[model samples]
Target: MLFPVLALIPATRTEPSSLLKLLAGEFAAQVAATWPEPHAAFLAAPAARRHLTCLALALGRDLPPIAERLLGGRLRHAIRLVLDPAPSGLERLLGRLGELAWDAEDYRTLLRLLAQRAPAKVLRHAQQVEPGAVRRLAGLPEPMGEAVGLALELTAEGVLVLREAYDALRLRDGPEAADVAASGWARAGSGKALFEAVRDDLTPEPLAPPHAGTTHLRPLRSKAELREAARRYRNCLGDRLSDAATGWQAFYEWEGPPGAIIGIQRDPIFGWRLEEARVGGNGAVPEAAREAIVSELALMGVHVGRSGWRLERLLRDDVGRGYRYWPPSQDVAEAFGDED
Candidate 1:
């Protein structure tokens, strides 16, 4: 389950610190105390465990403690998905919620709504409903509660769903929907009007992000294979290949040896638009070369965007830097010599 929050905010690749793991463990335990079934099931899955670990780490201390159980499975599943890449608007909305000084009750209400997978209709109704309804549901005062609740619901469904919802509402309710838009709903970034500005035709479906709990690197057998891969990529890109260099320059500016090797891998953290690659040789892969490779791939539309591959250093002695090794680890290498 990917967090709907991943769509908006960028996830960091840095490994979780011990402190964060501690916090996540405590939170998981608390959630278990209230709703044990989901928590136990969550612990059973390694990938889901990693999701919780990463999110708890990324969210850091800002992650509010779990005080009450609100349909634990949905909450736990959503929480796991929240670590993976998700809809941008939902991610931003979740970020705002994290930033707030949440009380126990606030967490309870928000978690409940998330568990329900609040529909766009909830948001539309939220706007039309009286102040009492807003206050009762969101616990915030009057219009603010209505706005936030609606935004939260739309975010849960993702930006695309939100757009469809708003479009349907406008077609059906007309002024009622307009009235909601006019009533400072746009003040919250999740609101319909604000979302419209950022909305584009790009859909998230085509982007093939790597599966969770997988290695980022894909090894090449030889420089010949590498060149062939590059050529194929260039051919796929055609004229857009020119933009590849520019795309590469946007992220890195360092220089390195010409013969130095590099390995492009999908990022384990962040969105599909971001990546992490291994740079081999005496020093890190030069910015110029990185620019060339990434620019071509990006231009070809192989990656999520123009600037996606994040570069890293490969240890000088690491033979795996430029070669294929199934299982991609020493355990496999020990079982069957390093080379195929």
Candidate 2:
């Protein structure tokens, strides 16, 4: 009986890295308390590999749980964000806000904003908001069924306009208009140059150059460039500022003739892949341009695949519809028939 009891006992698991806990600093408890066990264990597993980026994120003290699940729970892509440096908008926002304002709801809202629309706008508005802005700006219960339904429900820029409008209204329409603006975000309107001057946030940005050769991808570095591409290409790409700004989706212009815009997207399931290739008025790419784009992206380790298995779905009377995307090539890059 004693021998059997001794055999029944299992060995204890080893603790995670001591460095991870130590570097967690004042936020160690919050980190230990908040992140799920697997993520915590994952964080701890890389004791020797812990570099500045990991340390930076650990100190950030407020990022998403479950979601930072970058690239199959591997730190390779996640750290490359810090290494090669693309705009990881959430981290930048949290760093701006500091630890005190790091609420989970705010994190979720910012994440939603970064993932969906107006990431640059979100970053700008958050930065400019008055002290205690983080607490103030986060719309509770997250307004239903709206993109950027922020601050009495408006885009980040729209919120600023509302604030400006309310300030003007308060003086003209008495304290009522002013009161809301003072307490929180607000709105007002002017009739026929009632206020002649409000400078827009627009700033000059360098334009993407025409490609010397077949064409290569160039990043849309500013709101000006994005608007210009939208105007020049006449594509349905004007609204993706947040997606690009946050590195969830990125917009690039093919630097040559006929003017095409390229969109590269990173998804949990589909790491980095060419999401769209559009010319003027959302037109399809010419074969030469498309092939060139595909070839270049392949060099960068991006897949330029299109609907192969998905097309097979209709043939077999499958139950699911493939998500719509601008097909890169007339020829299927690879056949991965959609599984219903």
Error of 2 at 163 (Å): 4.3
For residue 238, give model 1's deviation from the true position in Å.
Answer: 55
Best by lDDT: 2
Write one digit per residue (lDDT tens) for candidate 1, span 214-301.
Answer: 1222333322334444453332212222223223211211123343223223333323332333233223334455555545445433
The best candidate by TM-score is 2
**Candidate 2 deviant stretches above 4 angstroms:** 1-215, 306-340
Worst 10 residues of 2 by lDDT: 194-203
Give the per-residue lDDT digits (tens) of candidate 2, residues 1-340: 8999988864432332354355444344444444433335436443322232333354453334432443234555554443345345543443354323233344444444455444346564564322233333443212211222244233455445545555565565556634533333211232112121221121123333222223376777776678778888776565665565555666777775756787766644345666677777776666566666777777666666643343444355333446443343432332111212
Candidate 2 lDDT at 215 equals 36
Window of ten residues with lowest summed lDDT in model 1: 200-209
TM-score of each: 0.17, 0.33
